[model samples]
Target chain A: AQSVSQHNHHVILSEAASLELGCNYSYGGTVNLFWYVQYPGQHLQLLLKYFSGDPLVKGIKGFEAEFIKSKFSFNLRKPSVQWSDTAEYFCAVRGSASYDKVIFGPGTSLSVIP
Target chain B: EAGVAQSPRYKIIEKRQSVAFWCNPISGHATLYWYQQILGQGPKLLIQFQNNGVVDDSQLPKDRFSAERLKGVDSTLKIQPAKLEDSAVYLCASSPAGVRAGELFFGEGSRLTVL
Candidate 1:
């Protein structure tokens, strides 16, 4: 079965610190990658997605992700993060067209202190 | 545009009790999805529907869980004789565009606790 994995389960950082959450997946074929964020008391929101083209995809809230097919990884990165950026990050993937189910990683909880 | 709506922000039931959750997807959304997110974990896809038809439910425990989207709109998910492990947040999502790709709007989710 296909699965997604996030290396860090919990992270704490000061405001303005750089952020990088590692995500990796196990799939044999092409896939659509995504990064989602869930702020407290809020629903999950899209951070960015990679369907095709450039490996580096920019998303809302100064977030970006790079899809490295060779590593089966799509890591989320932010040069500087604000306290408001503290939230749970999830990496997900669905098989390119042929697969329907979108698999999500366990998640990484980031706590940004001001 | 309105996002997906879910009812009963939270619920607590005994292990053997049955529970149900309701969701109303965004208007005109052809694809609807049900996901379960346990504490400290990412959302897990339970079922998917495209225009009232089942698209993918491989992860759903049909023996104790069932879901339906009537008329390709509103949806309901039910769990019979729920177990303690069934405790989790149930999320409803919609893809206004086809299920092909891109963004998915999600509801605030209904948290369930089975004692």
Candidate 2:
């Protein structure tokens, strides 16, 4: 079975701090990676996705993720985070070349103190 | 375009009861998805539908859970004899067909509380 792992369960940072959330997948075949965010009381929304392009992908709200094939990792990063950026983040992966199911990691809750 | 729409934003039922939730996908979207999100956890795919046919349902609990997209436009997910563990938010999402990597548009979600 394919699975995604997120190293951070919960993170607390002051405003304007840099953010990095680690994500790794357990799949040997080609994969599509994604980052989704859910603000408080809001539905899940896509942050960014890695289909088959440059390893570094930029997303909304100043978010970006680097897909490192060598490490089987797609880590989400931001140079500066604001209090509004506080939310629950999820990392998901689906198999490429096939319409396989998308698997989600446990999730990481980020809290940015103003 | 409007996002996915779900009905009965919140539901509370006792264990062993049956409950159903409805979802309406975005216009012209052929792919629909249903997910279960437990508190403090990420959403888990429960089923996926392409048009009026099921594309995937491996994670759905067949014994107690079932879902269908009758006209390939609207969908319903039902849980019979709901268990306490079934308390979670049910999310509905949809994407354009034939796209290899399209972002999903999600609804507000139906929150279920199985007491």
Best by lDDT: 2
- The local lDDT score (0 to 100) that residue A91 gets in candidate 2 is 96
Q: In candidate 1, which residue ranges exceed 4 Å CA deviation?
A: B98-102
TM-score of each: 0.96, 0.97
DockQ for candidate 1, C-alpha atoms = 0.67
**After aligning candidate 1 to the native by TM-score, how far in Å is the CA of B8 from where it should be?**
1.4
Indicate the residue-level lDDT of A46 in model 1.
Answer: 87
Docking class of 2: medium
Task: Candidate 1: give the clashing pairs.
Answer: none
Q: For model 2, what share of native contacts is present?
A: 0.58
Candidate 2 chain B lDDT trough over 10 residues, lowest sum:
B95-104
Worst 10 residues of 1 chain A by lDDT: A94-103
Give the fraction of reference interface contacts each candidate recovers: 0.74, 0.58
